[model samples]
Target: MTSEELNSNTTSKTQDNALGPAVQLTDEELSANPEYVLEQTLSTILSRPVVCDEESDVDQETNALFTDDDDGDNADGNQRTSNENNRHKQSDSPQTGLSRWKPTLHKPAPSIYILCSLMSVKVLAENLVLGVITDLTLAKIQKYYEDNERQSQKEFAKFQSVTSVIQGLLGISLCSKYGHLSDNHGRVFVLQICGLLTILGSLANLYIYKDSTTYEFYSFVFFYCIEALNAGQMSMVAVGNSYVSDIVSEDNRMVCISFFMSIMYATIGIGPLVGSFLVKIFKGNSFNTLYVALFLNVSYTLGVEFFLSESRTVNERRESQSQYHNEVLRKNLRKEQAIFSKESSKWSKVYHLLKMDTLIDLFKPLKTLWVPKTALGSLVPRINVLILVIIEMFVGGSVEGSVQAIVTYSMFKYSWSSVEIGYYYSISGVGRALVLLLAVPQLISFLKRRNYVALPDSIDRIDMIHLYLFLIFVITAFASMIVYETNDIGSYLNSLFISLSAFALPTVQNGVIKYASKKSIGQVFAAMAVLRHLMSLIAPPLYLQVYAATAKTFPTLFLYIPIILSALSLVLLQFVKIVKDHDMLRRQSEASFNNFDEHINNYSVNTKPNTSFDIANNLKNGKSNLQSNSIPIETTPLFKKSHFTGKDNIRNSYKSLRNSFVNSNTPSSKNSSLDKLKAQNFSAFNVPPSV
Candidate 1:
């Protein structure tokens, strides 16, 4: 018999024996098999495929549950058969054809080396000029006061305090602004803008340092104000860290962070040596470091502008901007509807939009810290995130507060020159680099492999350990400085050999970021930056003032502040809780299920047109060729075979279904089934009910 005759005969046999069978099938099986009488009836009525969990194959199904398997080796045979079947199906799919045409236009992402290099250069440049700023200010103070030592120290302290205050106030807004901007525009855009600001700040530094004799002390203040613009180093660190977070997965985030931080520490160690060398090259001119800094800034800025690509994708930018605009539109509509129902004045609308409440809304980014619950109202304890942020801010500010104080203190106590300060930082930098590059990674690996530390808890545990080690070393160093009248700089550098605490910054950041979503990362970092800047604004002046007051009688008294801050941070550290990796996976699954529910209300299937048979004529003639000899046209499945599949396809399918339903001229009775399908509970698709 011909193929068409044989297919029709087989289909007729299945339909005729449907009632006489000893075993029975449910409505779902009857609806799924096109050869079944019930499916034919339903398809004839609706001319649409019924939604089912899977297609039923009745040919291989047996009434007997117990089958004679050749010593259970048949199971292996069946598994092999299934694998072969899958391979055949994959071979027959259009994916094979599509896979052949690989796109050559695709470019590899820029190396992490570039980012590391950029950060190192930036750090080195800043370090090179760090001592110059203070020294120049002191020089101007001395020139003004005719070498009056006590008055010069007092003025220098005030200058430091005023600089911190101005920088802190401006930095908070700038960091917040750049964080939002990076989300919308791109990371590279923020990086480039911040780089240019750094360049300008460097130029201002060079100009001021070159003419300290010609200009007054206010020039240094102007330079410091310029440094605060666009958040300066704060913006760079936040945005750079954000970029690293974007490219690396959570699993390797710590390692990547450690890698870059090691580079930063290395530069910190080397920068002073280079700066002192350059000063000597110019015959003891501290201003020479400013020239090198300017050069490095220009080079790095150009490299960033030309070589670096935006980390945020086009789709992400569109989605983020869309949500923002939609939110604004919604708020405007609500306000107009509520207050301006009778009033048609434009000024009223503008005033309502630009009120003080709206101004206060700018700080809404800080809400990332207190993520009280998920979208579905599941409680997510993120208090640890807040704790980590406070710890970082307090610790970072305290560390920064030590720099100027230590610089001046060493100058007064040890009679150290600018070159000696350079050597001191260089040694400390080497110690820190060794810890981050070698010790941190090894310890993490050892814990994960040997101790079987859970990945989520590992970071928290390691961070705490590092913090403890840092605090211990810091306390010991300060105690020796205060208790013993240590005149030797070597002893100070020797005490800092335990710079293993250098791992604390990156690890703390890594742990805090575990609680953030991909979209909110920038805002979270920005909020942290704001807090750090606030501390910077507060801590420096306090340290400087205390040092100035005690410089004559008790120079070591200023060392107590960092020890206090470190102790407080360690106390807070004990309260932080670890979020397990599996819990994160569960949250992701819940999010995906939520998305599916949102899309399934309008779910659709797109059927391919059959060239051999007419779908339109089959409907019109009250017939279906799905069980006929003619090739059956297949409907495209909801989610096809793609590793990167997501909700975009679901949304598109929903739109297609809606359009087809609206444009169809079918009878209302036939369309009723489609409407019923839309209204059916998600359980119909065998999807588990959400919690």
Candidate 2:
């Protein structure tokens, strides 16, 4: 038979069956079929045939279960099958042709690398001229002091030192703002604007370079502060981490985070080397080198604008859906030649932007960070995760503050030069890159394989095991620092240990981040940055003061402070209550009766589609179909499908007579007998019930 005829016959046979309405595909069989449906839907949408990946067939089978249609219909086996066929018919839709909007980077890797590189370049450039700018500013500020050279330079140096920490604190303080901007506007937009601001600030610094007056110096400082305050870098980190998390669902999050972080860490290491090389090339002409870096920074901004795609979840999808809906409505209205009425006006739209609804959305990240309950009244890890994150940040910050102290220790103890100091700083960068590339991934793999670590993504909870790992690294770092020596090998070994000890910090950072509500990742990171920045403010001054007092006499005593702080953080982790997301509670609420709630909801919606109309039409059709196909037969000789049993044997003796009457169909006599038999049956007389 022809394909059309074959399909029609199959449909007719199934539809006309006696139990057609009651029959259903078994769950296992039904489960096997959604890929065929999703493949059809995507084919319709993208205008290209997409076979669901072979390895993911099992996973994609469940994907359709989660994906509901625009009209909120959760497709079932029969509905999905029908929808697939319908989509096949409409595959020629013009929306499917997207050649004009083709993206440059078809994969995640290139985009991630470029973004990380841009950030790396920015920080690298800034660090290169930071010292020259500081010294120049100190010279400018020296005029206010009446004391001799020693007093003027000393006070200015301390003040200038404060600027670095101040820049950090201010930048960290604005992480939240830029994070909001990233989410509301776009990550790349945040990058571009912030990069431009930095460039402008750098230019301002250049123009005011020779100004020995206090006002111009402060103006330069203020502009530079503006540059740091809008720290596009930290915002990018949060956004980039989130973006990578979204794209890579493979082997948990370690692979994606590890690779991206590795490249980023390597750039940071290479930056100093580049900066030192540039320093030599410029031969004390810091301004010339600064100008070159500024140019590259601008170029990076342009690259960000043109090349990087926005990584926000809600903004991108919501805007696209809105546009698509409008396009569809416009097309339909045009075809019908109907008036395309506008909703309210542009003024009302503008006014709505000021409404409380917009305000609530603006503060949703805050709510997600501070509030315990989520929008669905589900539990979130607002308190516990924040506490742990704070601890991590404090410990990290205290350790970070030890940088200058270590430099002091190196200089006073080992007599290291400027170039040697740069090399020393680069050691940590190398160590960090090594950890990112090797240690983090291996550790995660070890823990997961052993099943000691909870699945962070699935449960949305931080495992204490991660905390314990962080502790191990911290202790190891402390041990390495305790072994600090004046020799080159000992110094390098100390640096290596410091790096190894920090192996778990980034993992813990990513871990605590996961523990937070996915909706508030940016805000959580902001809070984290603030705590770190706050620590930076506290520890640097403290470390510097302590080092200045004791470095020549007892340099290693300074190292003990971080070790103690690390130990305290480890103890604090024990108190941190690791709250999981409500995923488990939700699962428990649903698992009984094998998804009964979902089934009931689906059934209610299915049975009540335009309740009155559907009830009337569907019931009538159901009744008719049930009635026609469900006629019962009597155990008589005329009914060949029936067999004689009990009273049927006796009835069979009279079957020939009954058949003679039934065959003749004398209307008056036969109709009454048939009607009586259909109405009721008795054991005394062999009578059949109605169908």
Q: lDDT scores for all predictions?
A: 0.59, 0.51
Candidate 2 lDDT by residue in tens digits, 30-149: 233322222222222223112221223222232332333332233345445544654563332211112125444432433566666676677666666666666556666566564368
Error in Å for residue 181 of model 1? 2.0
Name the best candidate (by TM-score): 1
Error of 1 at 426 (Å): 3.2
Give model 1's clash tally: 0
Candidate 2: TM-score?
Answer: 0.59
lDDT of 2 at 691: 12
Candidate 2 worst ten-residue window by lDDT: 15-24
The Cα error of candidate 1 at residue 623, in Å, is 30
lDDT for residue 280 in candidate 2, whole number 0-100: 79
